[model samples]
Every structure is written in structure tokens, then in C-alpha cells.
Target: MLEAANLTKKYKGLTAVDSYSLRVLPGRIHGLIGPNGAGKTTVFNMLTSLVEPTEGRVLFRGEPITGKRPDRIAKLGLARTFQNIRLFKELTVLDNILVAAQIHKQYGFFSAMLGLPSYTREEKALHHNAIRLLEEVGLAGLAHHKARSLSYGNQRKLEIARALALAPKLLLLDEPAAGMNPNESMELMGMIRSIRDRYDLSILVIEHDIPFVMQLCEHIQVLNYGQLIAEGNPEEVRSNPEVIKAYLGRSAEHA
Candidate 1:
């Protein structure tokens, strides 16, 4: 569903990402992993157009989307959640989702301001869609509750629901397992798999959770020092000498 070709990002004296490329097939889950400075996030930023790549282009379903604005890319069926949970903290869970659902809504200012029939119709549809996403994310019961009132796990789920509100064909999850307990991460694993099939969308996940990524992704790509180092399935990546050496070196450095 998505193809990144020769993606590179250079910041004056620093080359954050260099000559990286990967393919995300339709309806498949692809994973990216690397040690801390491997430019995993940089690659994601380029894909989503958060930051322009110095060189390289991204194609979504064979259409070039390189250098597109984030909002434009979003409207073109690409959506993502950050490594940090971002939500409308004060808004109700349903409201938070409603905000994202509006991306596809065509209710013009005049129609909404005048409460025209068209606006009303669009709103009803949005509400229905929001509720349905809530149910799918297992947050139906808490739709009316303030987002801040939910526990951490539920907050994470709420963010995911908000992203789903965009009706994206490609969902980029950045560190979905970050800051979650074992139980929560395990639940997220199941949720990711379920959504891939349920929504019929491709997913590209960047995660530090090795086991989770391995089990969740059908294909994997590894990065090191902002460059492509390895790419394969879970077992193949796990057994790769460079990947092993990188992790072991990281462990030793921390020790």
C-alpha cells in the first residue's frame, strides 16, 4: 500500500536518515526497528510528510505523495499516532474521535453556522461513525466520559480510535507499545492484528518491543545509524548478525 524509495534526511552536520527504503504491501503489517539513533522516527516523519526528506519520494498505492503537507496526506488516506499519546484531554472520548472524523466531512461553514439540513445530515453520520469506532476500539462504554478520566491504557486506545476516525488506508503507529505495561502491550498486540483485518488497511509500525513487533508484523525492516541495515521476517531479523551486534552493543553501553 505504501512504498518509500531512497528516503534520506540531512541536518547540516548530521545525517539523520540515509538511503532508506521499504515496501508496505496492501493489507499487510510491516515493522521497522532499530537501536536508539537509527533514524526510525525520521523515516516515519518523511512518510507522513511531517518533515521533508532531503532526497527520496514516497508512494501510496502507486501515487507519489512526497513533500505533501501532513493534512493533505491525511486526507489522502494516511494517518498516524505519535509515540506520545495525543488526545483532546478535556474532550469526551467521543468528542476526541469526532474531531478526527471531521477530516472527511464536507460541512461548510455557512451550512454549519446556519444549521442547514446538509450540515445536520453530515453531523449525524459523523456521530454514528464515531460511535462505531468507539465500539471497535473497546471504548464504547466510555464514549461520553472525559478523555482525562480514563486510565492510561484506555487513553492509548482512545488515541488509536481518534486516528481510526480519519478512515485511513495506511496507519502508521509510532511506538504503540511505549509506556505500556506487559498486559497493556499484549492487549495492543491483539488490537493491532484485529484492526488490520477488520479495517482492511495496511499498517506500518515502528516499535522497540521486539517480541510484539515480531509477532505482529508479517515483514520487518531494520535500520542502523539512519541507514538500512537489514530487512526480513521476524526470525530472519532476529538471527541477523548486525542486528544482534547492535543490540548487544547497546546493552553493554547501558551497563
Candidate 2:
């Protein structure tokens, strides 16, 4: 579970996020949506410690993690994917996941250099787990292929797979459906649900795809001009007057 209190971020004259607060319960999926420049990504950066907040704090499972290093936060069981795909283009897909799985290494570098039994054993286990993670995201068969060779949607899934290698308790996904076609988006929705149930994960996603968020998230929060405008179930948010006038506007009619 994660909780953010009065989170605010400013860059010189601009307040990117203003007093935004929200909580994600265990094993639940939550969505954050807003117009461009609404600071959705800024909130994520603050939560992950990629950027320090100008004010307020973040709690992950009750411990404050506001200024912790991103790797430290990840080691504590939080992982995230970027809006733009970030993959090691030249690495084999399996190797890309193997890189993330290094967090679970139980042996020292000397052990690895000497090919000690402990290092070999742990490395073998990580390989097995990486393959299993790739399979879960429907990319097992492409494990040996170069990461840059996958299709756009498949690349998105690969990023999620790499994040899963971290074995996170909470996952923050930024625009997971950004470039997917309708069919791919639907597949991703199903995959996300399966992951939540199978991994017992709590997900907080920031997505511009309205219908995708509406169908995937159990709870939704709307932001506009760096301020929270609405928070509710999909139906409640879809019908809220303030949300209609703010982020959704005329799009609400189609939504």
C-alpha cells in the first residue's frame, strides 16, 4: 500500500503538482488522469524519489520514503515503468530481464568471478524466474531476440516484464497503453488484471487512455492545472461536473 500526503512540486515559477493526495490499497488498481502538463508524471517522479517534492511526504506501507534513492525504494518493493519505453535495445530480451533480476543476487562479485556454487545456483534461479516473468507477459518465445526487434506493443509488455523481475509489491505504470491499438490495449488490460491477481500486486497507473483507465482501474483520480479535481469510482468520476469541465470536458460525452 502507498499513501501520499499534500504532495506539491514547483519548478521556479511553476507549481507542477499542487497539494495532491491519494492512497492505493493493497491489491487494488488505481488510475491517475489529467490533461497534458497536469503533473501526473511529476507525482510519480516524487513518489519514486526521482524528483524530490517541494512539500509533503510519501509513505509506502507506512514508512516514509520521500527522499530515499530510487533504487532503495525499488528494493523496498516498489517498481515503475516509464511513459516512453526504456529498454536495452541491443540486449537480448531475456538478458534485459536478467539485468533487473540482479537485484535478487545472493552472491558477491568475487563469488561470481570464481564461479562459486552459490553464485551459479542463484544465477540459475534468476534465469528461471526471468523466463517465467517473460512468459507471464507473453514474450517467452522471444527471449533470445534483440529487444529492439519487438513490435511496439510487445516492447511495452517487455518493459512490464522487466519491472516484474524486481518482484515489486506495488507497481506504478505510466501510460501502459500509450501506443497500443484497441486489440493490444484490451490484451494489456487482461494481462494487467492477471498480474494483479497472480502477483498480489497493488497498481497505480497514470494513463491518458480514458476508456482503458475506466475499465482497468477500480478507483480513479482526476487532476487539472496541477490540482486534484475529482476522486472516485469510474462511474462517479465520469459523471462529476468538475471533471467534465476540467480534464474530460466534451470527451466525457463520448466516454
Candidate 3:
């Protein structure tokens, strides 16, 4: 559902991302993996329109979406979560999700001042939907709790919940398991699978946890030194000599 062609990004003397091309099919979890500085996050930023690519194009459902503003891309059914958690610390979990849902509504100053029937109905529906989303992510019980009060794992799930409030066709998740313990990460893996199936989503996940990616994603793409070094199924990617030598490396010290 999403295709990137020869996508490249550079910053002055450094080429952060090389000409990389990949496709994400509907209802599949595609994994993007690399060592630090492989430019995986740069690729995510370019794809999500947060950073303009130095060269190449990004197409969503066959239409060019490169160079669009982040909000515009979001309105076109692409949503993302950051590598680090981004949430309103003071807002309640439910309120955080409600804020995201408001993007889909037609709210204006006059509508709010006059309390128009349409605006009221939309607001009510947004609340219900936000609660539902929170419930889906296992945070409904903590809806009224401040975002900062949640545990680290719950915070990650809340981030996902907030992203789902945008109703995206394609979801870009950067390191969903980044700071989680083993149990939390394993729970996240199950949640990812469940949500992917439940929403019929096309997901692109950039994760440093190799075993998690291998076990969860249908296909894996490997990058090293800002280049697409390997792209294949888990087994093929795991056994690839170049991938092993470049990414995993030969010696135990390298791993």
C-alpha cells in the first residue's frame, strides 16, 4: 500500500540515507532493521514527511506524497509514532487520545462558542472512539489517569492507541520495544500482531531488537552504512553472509 523509490536523504557532508526502495503490502508487518546510524530513522522521517528527502519519491496507494507536510500526510491515512515517546504528560490518557481524534472532526471557534449540535455530536463520538481505542490497547481502565503516571510499557501502548485514533491505513512505528523489559517486549509483540489483524493494517516497524523483528515481521530489510544491504524473509536475511558480516558481524564481540 506504500512504496518508496530510490529514497535518499542527506545532511551537508553526510548522506544519512542512501537510495533505498521498498514496498509494504496490505495486512503485513514489514520490519526495517540496521545497526545504529544505518539511517533507518531517517528513512522513517522521510516517509512520514517529517524530513524532506534529498532525492526520490514516496507513493501512497500509487499517488506521490513526497514533500507534503506532516499533517497533510497524516490526513491522507499515514500515521506514526516517534522513537522516543511523545505524549502530553499532563493530559489524561483518554484526553491524549481524544486530542488525536479531534484532527478528524470539523471543530471551529464558532462551533465551540455556540455549542452547535453537530459539534456536540462529533465530540461525543470522538470520546467514545477514543475510549474504544484505549480499550483496544489495554489502557481503558487508566483513561482518567495522567499520561505520566503510566508505566513505561503502558506508555508505549498508549502511544499506539493515540496513533490509532488517527485511523491510519499504514502505521509507522519506530522502536516500539526500545526501552521495554523482556516481558513487556513480548507482550508488545502479541499486541502488534493482534492490532495488525484487527485493523487490517500495513505496518512498517523499525526496531533494533533482531529476535523480535525476526519473529514478528513477515519480511525483513537490513541496512548498513545508509545502504540497503539485504532484503528478504527472516530465514534468508538471518543467513545472508553480507548481512551477517556487515550487520551482525563475524565475531562474538561484534554481536
Model 1 Cα lDDT, one tens digit per residue, 18-105: 9888889999999999989889998999999999999999998888999888998999899999887889899999999999998898
lDDT of 2 by residue, 1-255 (tens): 999999999999899999999899999999999989889999999999999999999999999999999998998999999998999999999999999989867899899999999988999999999999999999999999999999999999999999999999999999999989999999999999999999999999999999999999999999999999999999999898788877546555554
> How far does residue 193 in candidate 1 sit from its true spot (Å)?
1.0
Residue pairs of candidate 1 with colliding backbone atoms: none
Worst 10 residues of 3 by lDDT: 246-255
Which residue runs does candidate 3 get wrong by more than 4 Å?
A: 251-255
Q: How many backbone clashes does candidate 2 have?
A: 0
Q: Stretches of candidate 2 above 4 Å error?
A: 248-255
lDDT of each: 0.90, 0.94, 0.92
In order, how many clashes per candidate? 0, 0, 0
Q: Which lDDT value does model 1 have at 87? A: 91
Better of 2 and 3 by lDDT: 2
User: In lDDT terms, which candidate is top?
Assistant: 2
Model 1 ranges with Cα > 4 A deviation: 250-255
